[model samples]
Target: MEILDHLDKLKIFIAVAQRGSISAASQELALTQPAITRAIQTLENAAGYPLFTRNRSGMQLTQGGQILFETAGRVLKEVSDATLRGAHVRTEMAGTFTIGTYESLAEYLWPDFLLKVQKDYPLINLSIRTDSQRSHLEELNNGTLDLLVDAEPRHRQNLAMWPLYTDRFSFYATKAATELNPETAKNLTLLYVRNAFDEDNVTIESHLKSAGYQFQQEYTFDSFTTVKRMAEKGLGIAVLPQRLADKEGKLKLIKAKGFKEGFGHHGIFATVSPHRENDRRIKTVVNLLRKQLS
Candidate 1:
């Protein structure tokens, strides 16, 4: 069997064993249930034995599965450490670097970042994963993500974070929408990304709350692009990052009494799993990104 394919199967097996169910592993890894099940079956076929005993209680790993889990885990860790160590000694950044971040920032930064990195380090392979949510430490800890650029998460002790820059947020609406002073701002409908309310690191709700505006009507969207588009069509006032808001010519930035200064700025961070703190290739990527933004 190919080493890469074997390692991929091992990863699926480890996730299943740790999560105790195929459904949970599928959810965590963003794979379909059948795909995860097929990986397990393929691994079992290769081993010439059943790895998990199926039951209502959940999958119980057999002796072979337990042995494979312990050994494969060590092998994965060792391979990662060796790769990072080699990267540290190399003169040029070369190797696969996977990064994750929020979609809004990715939309603004990724195209330029990708071009600059490829121009400087042609040998390096870069992969980017963008999501609407703020918490990606799970992917980082699992070794699927090499680096992340986002607002610092609330539970931050698990990963090492380097503060990159701050991006302020503000209220915006279509130019045709009703004028919003402090008194009128509270009456206008609100539209925003759903993660803004759910994530502790994001302060959209906090800013509105402090301004004493308890919006009676609100629209939540998963995409900042969509939120901005809706706001431009006179749907509602959207709370958006300053950079994103500035790009929309049809949208007018609100200058209410309490919010004239902008909602607030959150520090964007370049983060990695603590184990990669000393890896030079990763550091180079982070520094290049900082320079691109600067």
Candidate 2:
């Protein structure tokens, strides 16, 4: 008779045979000693023969058991390989996965991108959290999130990153705003989005400082909505990413003073916990994003 009916028993037999002791199998499988013994007994009774021979050292496979072990191993390997292949092909997988991103991307970037994902993987549900990039990174590390889609954040250990696209910063306003440089920024109030969680504004300050960008007076708001609105009304110059600022084709660009084009550019990334780098769920989402955004 085929042992396929008792897959659990087959697994246990292989573990015991390889380890040479039921106790070792128990440790490997995280099962109790008595439980493993019961399983072995149940399997042997069905076959009308003991699969193992007892000895001073430990249990050794009987002649029939040795023959069955080889066949069982091949069957198990094939089953596992087939299952992995199914996942690799990105079909027949189900369940919801959480992805953390920024509010700007959630508004301008994800609508079309999400439609594409839904069309491709109808069963894969995505719960998108539009929070600050810093908060997303923390949630990712603390296991509250499965994946992250945002511009490059600080590299941390045990994290994996894949580039999606390069986004450049731009100056936008209702009218042709003054030239985008530190000197002109001091005259016109610099409008920028800040996360509520960023109490000290340390990250934004550091980022602007690196590019020699400084404004004597600034308009800091919690969301891009407020920043964009302020700029549209001719209140201040809005500093935003090119894709986000021009997504609707409403906002106009305010050219910079120097030969260098936009304020600066950064690579948008698909980040995840390093252990899940090759996971089918992660791979599927990342591939879709790369196709749409890159």
Candidate 3:
């Protein structure tokens, strides 16, 4: 296939960009770091964009690198996804597969995921429900939903989870707003989504409270979009997913040690009923989802 051929050429590029370093990429590909570095040099000559901008943080993808990464993700998905599709033949795969997830992830991430599933398996009815992860997990157990994709589904058992990606929370404020730290952040009203579960203990608010982080005036919104919009207008400082904030590009990241130390990072997982974990339909979707995001 044309897509497969294209993916082969970009495999090294994609692996390096995804792992953020030649060493990590080499480790993943089982190649020497020097070999990885030399391959990247070759790729840079062919690609119009330099592909990476190295900093102290490692190989940050340049605009061109980012573009290449996304493009490769779209095409290589046909291949990286082979884990799910590798051993399973889809010749007779046909059934309804429903994915239930939270509001923001569905809006920001799932368009391509669901679209690819539909394109590949037209016979299977694909549906997506975006209410709440908690309810979605329950629905999976009830057979109302086939997959529950969320940021670390908790408590419930008998479901097998596959890690897809990570979305970290960050402190965002108007570009003009005062720079924030744990102490100064208290001076600004905090706009955040209400914790869906108080007992979960994994929520941003719970972690902040436990860390002695304080927000003098706090506002809770049922929707993250509302919180983001309000924060953009300088209404208050907000803690939001870094991916969402990057898309807006207007909110400035606040340099708070607490926010910077990875307290808010959560792994996004695709979960399914254990019984159907190896079903062709399930594997196809999970690996496809992994390709789209990874």
The number of clashing residue pairs in each candidate reads 0, 0, 0
Residue 52 displacement (Å), model 3:
62
Q: Pick the candidate with the highest TM-score.
A: 1
lDDT for 180 (candidate 2):
77
Give per-residue CA lDDT, model 3, range 139-233, as digits (tens).
56645567888775665666788888877777788774454667776666888885833223477778777767788899998877788889988
Name the runs in model 3 displaced over 4 angstroms: 1-90, 176-178, 194-200
Taking all chains together, each candidate's TM-score versus the true structure is: 0.72, 0.59, 0.61
Best by lDDT: 1
- Please provide, for model 2 over 39-153, each residue's C-alpha lDDT reduced to its tens digit, 9 standing for 90 to 100: 7787777667889998889999898876677567545644654565556565545555678887767887788877877887676666788876666765566445678987646
Question: What TM-score, to 2 decimals, does candidate 2 have?
Answer: 0.59
Error of 2 at 118 (Å): 1.8
Clashing pairs in 1: none
